[model samples]
Target: MARASSPKRKPSRRPWRRRLILALKILGVIAALGVIALAVTVYTTRAQLPSFDQLKSSPNGQMIRVHAADGTVIVSLGPSYGEWLSYDEIPKVMRDATVSVEDRRFRSHIGIDPIGVLRSVKLMIANWGTDRRIQGASTITQQVARTIFLSNKYTLSRKAHEAILALALERKFSKDQILELYMNKVYYGGGAYGIDAASRKFFGHSAKQLSLGEAAVIAGLVKAPSHYSPTADAEAAIGRAGVVLQLMAETGAITPEQAADTDPKSVALAPEPHQNSVRYFTDWALPQLDMLIDETNAPLDVWTTLDLSMQRAADTAIKADVPKGVQGALVSIDRDGAVRAMVGGKDYVSSIYNRATTAVRQPGSSWKLFVYLAALEAGYKPDDMVVDEPVTIQGWSPRNDSGHFSGAMKIRTALAYSVNTIAAKLGQDVGFHTVADMARRFGITTPIDTTPAMVLGTSEVHLIDMTRAFASVANKGIAVTPYGITKVTANGVTIYQHEVDRSHVLVAPYVAAEMTDLLQTAVATGTGRAAQIGRPVAGKTGTTTSNKDGWFLGFSSGLTTGVWMGRDDAKRVGGLSGGHAPARAWHDYMIKAVAGRPVEQFDTQVTLPEWQLEPDEESYFGQPDNGMFVDENGYPIAPGTYPGDTPTGPPPQQGYPDAYPGGTYPPDGSRTAPPEQPPVQQPPERLDQDWMDRVLGRTPDPDRRAAPAPARTPPPNDRSRGP
Candidate 1:
C-alpha cells in the first residue's frame, strides 16, 4: 500500500523535470548530426590534396640537359610540345592497334565501363587470390589518372581517389586532352621520356613518322616499358607488335589485308656509347660545375674546350697500339693549356683508375728539364762543359749508364743523352735547392728531393703535371693551368665559364728555346727516337731504374702529349723501355692527331755552341820506358820519369797505355802511343778563363761544383796499388 502511494506522489512532484527530458532528446539529435559532419570534413580534406601534375609543373621541378663540346644536340629536356592528335591524327590502324593492345573497352566506358569491372571481378573470384592475370578494369581515363596523378598502391582508398580524380579530369577536359596528356607523359625506356621521344630515340624518327607496325610496337610499351623496349629485347618487341596488329584487325580497326600489308622495318638498335669523346674533359668539367651550381638540379649546358675529333683520334690510337695487360695514360693539351684529348687508362670501363690525372710515378729523366732550366736560370749555358765521369757526393757515387767515363761533354749532350752522371753533376753544380724550387714553380706538386739525384728525375709526378710542364715550355715559359670546361649555360643563361691564367715563370725565352732544342735532339737521334714525327717534334724519353717505369712526353706545334706506362704496383716489367713502348704509343697517337695539320716547328733560334771533348791523360804521357833512359847511377828508368825515381816529384797519374815502346810515337796523330804532354797544370789565365766561361759558363758555387781534380792513381812502387 505504501509503494503504490509513493509512485503516484513522485510523478506529480516535478513539471520542470518533464521540460528537461524534452531538451535532452533534442540535444541527442544535434550530437548525432555533428558526428556525421566531422566525418564528411575529414574525407573531403584528404580527397582534395594536390596531385602529381600540380607538383610536376611546380617551380622546383628537376631540370635535364644533353650537350656536347661542339653545340650538337642529341636530345633535350621537358615535355615535347607539338600539338598531339589522337584517333583522327593517328592512323585508324594505329588507333585500333593501341585500343586493341591496351584497352578493349575504350569506347564503351563512361570513365570506367562497369561490364569490364564485373568480368574482372568474376575472373578474380574464380581464380581466388592467386590470379594477377585478371586484367584491371580501369578504363583509359582511369589509367591516365593512375599513371599521372596517383601511385600504383592497390587499395580501396587509392582506387577511390583514382576514380574521383579520373571523373573530375573528364569533366575538366575532353577525351582528346586526356589521351594526349597520357601519351606525352608515359616512359618508353632507352632514355626516352614519352612516345614521341621513344619513337625518335629508337627508330631515329618522329612520332608522326611511325608506320602501323612501328606504332604497334610503341603502343605495346604502355603496359611494360622494359619488356617491349626495342633496345632491351628486339625479338620480344617484334612479337608483341605482331599481336597488336592482329588485335587491331580483330577489333575492325584495320582490315586483315591491311594488317598484312604493313610491314615495319626491323628495328636495329645500337648500344649507346657510354662515354663521350670528351670523357676526360667532361670528367674534369663536372667537378667545376659542382662548385658553381647545385649540381643535383642544375639546369646548365656545359660546353667544354675538348676537341672531339682529336679526342676520338687519341682514343683510337691508344686502343690500337697500347699492348694488352699494360695500362697507360695519354694527355694532350693545347698551347693555351686547354685539354684537347685524354685517355685516362687503356679501358675506362675495365679500370676507372684515371692514370692520366691520378697516377703519380717517377718522371725519370723527364724531370731533368727542370734541373737544366734551373742551371740556365743560374747563368749556365747549354754548351757548358761538364765531366760525364764518376762523381761522388756525400759518400754517394753516381755512375754513367754503362759505367764508362765519357770525359768532358757539353751540357746539351748530357741532357740529350740523359746521362745520369752528367745530370747529377750539373744538378749538384746548380744547387739542388734551386732545382727543387724550379720544379715547384713548373707545376710539380710532388715533393722533390734536394739531393743531386733529383736531376735524374727521382721525384714522382702525375702525367697531367708533366704535360702542363711541357706545355709551359711550348707556351714560351708561361705556366698555364690546365682546364676543360669552356662555358656552362642554364636556361639560356651562361652560369659559368673558365678563364685560364698564364703566369710567366721563366724570365728568358732563350732558356726554354735551348731546352726545347735539346729535347728535340733526344727525339731525333737519342732515346726518344721512336717518337719522331715526320716534322719537327720536341720530346723527352724517360726510363726508370731497372725499367720500373716508362714515359714519353712530347709536343707538336699545337698540342703536347704525355704517355706513361708502368705496373700499378710499381714493379718492373721486363723488356719494357720508354723508347720502345711508350714512345711508340706516343708516336702513333701523334701521327693520327696531326695527320692533316700543318707542320709547326718550335721557334727557338738560340745557337748551341759546338760540342768539344777534352783530351785524355794518356795523350799527354809518353810511352813507358823499357831501359829507354838511364839514371846518373846507371839505373834504367821510364822515359817520362827522372833517373832518381825516388817518388819525390808529383806521383804519376794513370795515363792510357803507350802503343809504342821506348817512347817511339806513330807519325800520324792517330798513333796508339802517348803523343805529347798536355798543357801543364797551371792556374787558368785570361784566355783559359774566357774559354771556361764560354764553354762551361761561370763555375757554379764551389760547394755546388764537381771536384776539379782528377782521381789520383797509386805510385808504381806503392804497396796500396790493386793488382
Candidate 2:
C-alpha cells in the first residue's frame, strides 16, 4: 500500500484540471474571435444598410384597374389596398401569431439568433443535397433585411450579410417597427402582398380587424404562400393554422385552453373566387399584371380589346335564352380576332367553368364549313351537283335531316338544306384527310378524327376557336390570334403594348369568298335561316345525332359570333338542333352588338379558275386517278354507264367503297339512265315514253298511257344512316 501510494506521483499533476484549463482557453479564444468577427460584420452591414426613413417611400404592391375599350373600368385586380398601414395599424393578435409561427423569440434576437443559426446549420448538414431549409431560422429582422436591405441570395455570404443587416436593423429600430415591416412586406397568397391586401382579400377587412383564427391562418402562409393559402387550399391552411395556434399557446401569447378551443376550420373566408365580369377572362389576364408593373407601385390602367356593350349583350343573351337547367356560351370576335364579347355561362358565380374558350363539345353539322371549303378547293363549284339522295359509304349511309331523299340538287341547294348525304359524298370525294388538314390550317386547334364522321363535326371544339375560324373567313383567309389586352400604362406612360401580328395567313381570298357565298345561302334559305340578321350574314347550323349539343356559327362583315347550348353532363338535349335556340341566340346577339357599326361586306371575290376537265373517255376502270369522267359540257359524270359502252368489270369504288351491298348510280344521281346493256327485252312503249318525259322535265300525263310510278327508294334504316 505504501508503494502504490508513492506511485500516484502527485495525482498525475491533475491531468483533467490541466486539460480543462486548456479547453477553456481555446473556448475563450474562439469566443473572442467570434465577437470581433461579428462586430466587424455588424459595422460593415451598418454602412451598407438602408435608411429607416426610406420606409415611408418603400415600394408597396399596387392595385391595377382593367379598362374596357371605351375606357370604362372592367375590374380592379391585384392588391386592392386603399393605403399602406404603419405597424400600429396591424393588430396584436396578428403580430403575435406571425412572430410565434414565422419566427418565435423574434423580440429577443439581435438581427440573427445563434441558437437559430446552430439549428439551421444542423439541418443543412443533415439534408446534404436538398435545397430544403428544414427549419427557417431567419429572424423577422433577418427577413426584413433580405426584403428591404439585401438580396435574397442563398449563400454563406448572403446569410452573413443578412445577419449583420438584421443586427443593424434591430439597433436602429424597435421590435414593433421591425414587426410592422415584416407584416407589410410578406406575401399572403392570391395576388395579395402585405397584411392590408391579404386581410382585405381573405377576410374582407383590414389587418386590424382579424380574429385569432384568421390571424393564425394568415400567418401560416408566410412559410409557403400559395401552398398554405386559406382561400386556395383550405384543408392544408387550416392544419397549418392549428400548428400556429399551438405555438402561440406554448409561447404564452395565448392560453392553452384558448388554443384548444379555437377551430381553424371556423375561419370566415371571402366569397369563393369571384369577380364583377367574366371570372375566366379576369383570371386569364392576371399574369399580365406582373408583366406590366415592373416594380412600380403607382396605379396602372390595362386597356383591353373587350367591347363592354357587346359583352353585356352576350351575357344577357345567355341568361335570357339558354334553356332551363342547360348551359350556354357565346363568343363574338372581330375580323382581327379581337374578343369583343364573351359569356362563358349564364352565371359565372354559380359555375366558373368557362364553356366559351375552355369546354369542348361536338360541333355537329357546323363542321361542314371546313368540308365545303375542302370541296371548293378541290375544284367543286357552287353549281356542282350534290344529289340530296340517300347514299351509303363504307357501311355508313347518310341522309337528309328529314330522313327523306331530295333528289339531285346543286351544292348550294344541298348546303342550304343541310343534306347529310351530299356532305358525306363530297367529303369522300375530296378525302377526309384533306378536310382535316384544311380545318387545322384555318383555326381549329382541336384534334380531328380522320374518319367520315368528322365531316359531320364529330370532333369536339371550343366556341372561341370555332368562332375564331369563322372570324378568319370574315377576315378574308388571314388567321387572327385572339387577344385581350390592347395597352397597359401608368401615369400616362405605356408599360406594355400588344404586338401586331401579321402572320398565320391560311386561305386564299377566292376560296373564302366561295365559302362565304355558299354559307350565305345556308343562312338565307337553309337550316341557318333562323340566324339571318338584317344585313348579309353567313352561318351554319349544327346538331349532333343524339341532340347532345347544338351550335350556330355565323359571321357578318363586321363581326362573327358563335353560340353553344347544351347540358354540362353530356345528357341529350332532346329535339334541340342548331337552327333552334342557338340560331336565334346568335341572331339576337349579333344584331344588337353590331348596331351602328358600318355594314361591311366580304371582299370582292377574285375570278375563279375554269372547272378542270374530267377523266378521258378512252380511260378504262383503272384509268387516271383524277376522280370521275367529265362530259363534253365540262360537268363531272357520276360513276356508272354511258351510251354504247359496256363496263368491263365493277369500276373500283372511286372515293369510298360502295357502302351498300350493291347500289347503282344513273351517272347523274337519277335512277334512269341511257342504254348500256341490250335494250331490256322489249321496253314497254308507255314505259319508254315515261322515261323520255321524266328526262325531258315533262310530268307524264294520266291521259297518256298510265304507268306505275318508278319504285320509290326506301328510307334508310337507323343502321344505314346511323347516329
Candidate 3:
C-alpha cells in the first residue's frame, strides 16, 4: 500500500535534481582549482625567467670559431652564428617549409595552440591504445622560448617556463618579430645556430637564395641534424626533405603539383673544406682553451697554426690512396712544432677517432730512429762497420724486412736498409734503457719497455708524437712540444698568446746531422725512396708484422710529417707495407705541401767512411763482375777506385752492387741510383727562438709559457710487432 501511494506521488523530482546540481558544483570547483594551479605555475615560472631583452642579447649563445693561418674559418665549436637576416630577407619557401613541417598551426596559435594540444592528446591516447605514433605539438614560439630561456630537460617546471616565456614573448613582440627571432635563434646541425648559417653550411648559399627543395631539406634538419645531415647521409636527408614537401602540400603552403615537381635529390650540398676534416684539429685544440683562460660565454677568435692549403693537400692525398677497410692518418708540423696540417682518418664523417693525435700504433722500423739515435749518442759514427748477420738478444731474434741480410755494412747502410738484426744488436750494445731515454727526450711521452723488440718499433707511438720527434731533428736537435693555438681573443680583447717555448735540446746538432744523413740515404735510395720529393728529404719507413701497420716519418723543407696506415681493429691489410703505401702518401703530401716554398736543404750533409768490399765479397754477395763500389759520398766508383779518381767504366751506372735497399725494393728497380742532386735554392730566413710568435703576428713573450695539455697515453697492450 505504501509503494502504491509513493508511485502515485511520482516521487517528487526535487531530491534527484538537487543531487545533480550538487555534482555540477563539485565539477566546477575542480575546474576552478585547475585554473588556479595553472595560473600559479605560470606566475612562478615567469618570476624565475630572464627578461625578453636579456634573452635576446645573451652572450652565452655565442660560438668559438677556429681560423687557419690565412684567416680562413676551419671549424666552429659551440653554437655558430651567421649574419642575422631580417624577416624580409628570409626566403618565403624557407618560412613556409619550416612552418609546414614544424608546426602546421603556427599561424593560428596565440603563444600556445589549444587545438594542437588537444589533437596531440588525442593522438597520444590513440598511440597508447593502437600503438600509433604521435607528432609533438610544440609551437614555433614555444620552441623559441625554450631555446632562448629554458633548458632542454623534460621537466614539468621547464614546460611551465616555456609556456610562460612564449606567452610573454607574444605579448611583447609582433608576430613578424617573433618569427624573425625564432628563425635567427633555432639550431640547424653541423654547428650552425641560425637560418642564415644553416643555409650557408648545407647549401653553400644564403637563406635568401634557397630553392623550394633546398629550403625543405634544411627545414627537415631541425628535427635531427646528425641523422639528416646532407653532408653526412645525403639519402636520408633527401628522404626527410620529401616528407617535408608532402607536409607543405598538405598544409596548403605549396600545391601538390609544385611539391611533386621539386626533387629533393636535386639539392646540392656545399663542398666542405677537406670534407670538414679539420674537426680533428678543433676537437684536439678546443679542450686546451680551458687551460688558457677562465670559462667564458663570449665568442672567441682562435687563431690556430693550421694551414688550410696543406690540410686540403693531406686530405686529398689520403683519400686518393688509402685502400678500403684501411684507415690512414697524417700529422705535419713546422720546425717549431706548430701543427700545420692533420688528417685523422681517411674520412672523418665515417669515424671521429683521432688517429693522428690519440691512436698509438707500432712504428716498426721507424722506432729504430730512437735506437740509432741512442747508438749515435753512444759514440757510434755513421761510417762505423756493423755486421747485419743473424743476431739474438734476450732470446728474441729479429729478422730483416728483406729475408736475406748482407754480412757486413756501414752503420748508416744498415739503418737505411732497416735491418732488424742490426737494430737489435745496436739496441743491445747501446742498452735498451738508453734507447728508451732517447725516445723520451724527443717528445715521445708514451711509456717504453726496455725489451729488445722495442728497438724494432714493437712499442706503440702516436703519429703526432712521432711527427714531433722528427720535427726536433728538423729543428736542429731542439725539442719540440707540438702546439696548435697561436692566439685566442674574446670580445675583440686578447686573452691568451702562445709563447715560443723550446727550452730543451733533445740531441746535439752534430748527432742530429748524423741521423739525418742515415735518414737521407733511406729516402734517397733505400727503404724510403718512395718518399723522395726531388729535394733533400730524411725519413724512416715502418711496417708491422702481417702488415697490420705501415708508417713513414720524414722531414723536408722545414716541415716534418708522419703518416700511419692500419685498421682500427688491428686486422691485417694485405699488400700494405711502409715502403709502398705510407712512403708514397708522405711523398704525395710533401710534394704539394712544399710547393712554391724555397726548396730548403738539411744541415750540411755529414761525411761518412766509404765501404771497401773484400776481393771475393762482391762475387759472394751476387754482384756483377763489372760492379762499381759506392764511395763515402754514395757515388758509384770502379772496383779498387777511390774518390776524385775517374772511374774506368761506363758513366755512374744505376743500382747498388752488394748492399740492397731496405724494406721492399721497388718492383721496377728504377730507384737503384741515389737521388739526383737538386739545384740549390735559397733557404728561408733563419728563425730564432721567437720565430713562431713572429709568424703568428704577435710579439714574443718568453716569460709567459702556458704548459701544454698532457699527452694521452694508450693502454699497455697497444703494441704491434715489427717486421
Best by TM-score: 2
Error of 3 at 541 (Å): 0.4
The TM-score between candidate 3 and the true structure equals: 0.55
Candidate 3 ranges with C-alpha deviation above 4 Å: 1-59, 80-274, 606-723
User: Each model's TM-score, in the order given?
Assistant: 0.51, 0.61, 0.55
The C-alpha local distance difference test score for the whole of candidate 3 amounts to 0.74
Residue-wise lDDT of candidate 1 within 283-357, one digit each (tens)?
555556556654444465767666667777777766765555567788998888888788887665455467888
Clash numbers, per candidate: 0, 1, 0
Best of the candidates, lDDT: 3
Which ten residues in a row are the worst by lDDT in model 1?
A: 618-627
lDDT ranking, high to low: 3, 2, 1
Model 2: per-residue Cα lDDT at residue 509: 76
Q: How should the candidates be ordered by TM-score, best one leading?
A: 2, 3, 1
Clashing pairs in 2: 111-166
lDDT of 3 by residue, 1-723 (tens): 465544345678999999999999999999999988867766666576566456656543557888999988876668767878888999999889999998887777778989888988888887786746565778899998877766565666877777777776666667777788888888888788888899889888788898999999989998988779887678889999999999999999999999999999988887765546888888788779878876356789999999989999999888866667789999999887789999999878766678999998877778888988888888888877677677766666555533565666677777766666778788888888999989988878787867667776767789999999988988888888889999999988989999877778888889999899888767654567678777678988777654567788999889999999989997656546677677778888989998867867667552322222211211112111111222222223344353322222222232333223322333322223335744344333322324424432245787856444333342132231221
Report the candidate with higher lDDT, 2 versus 3.
Answer: 3
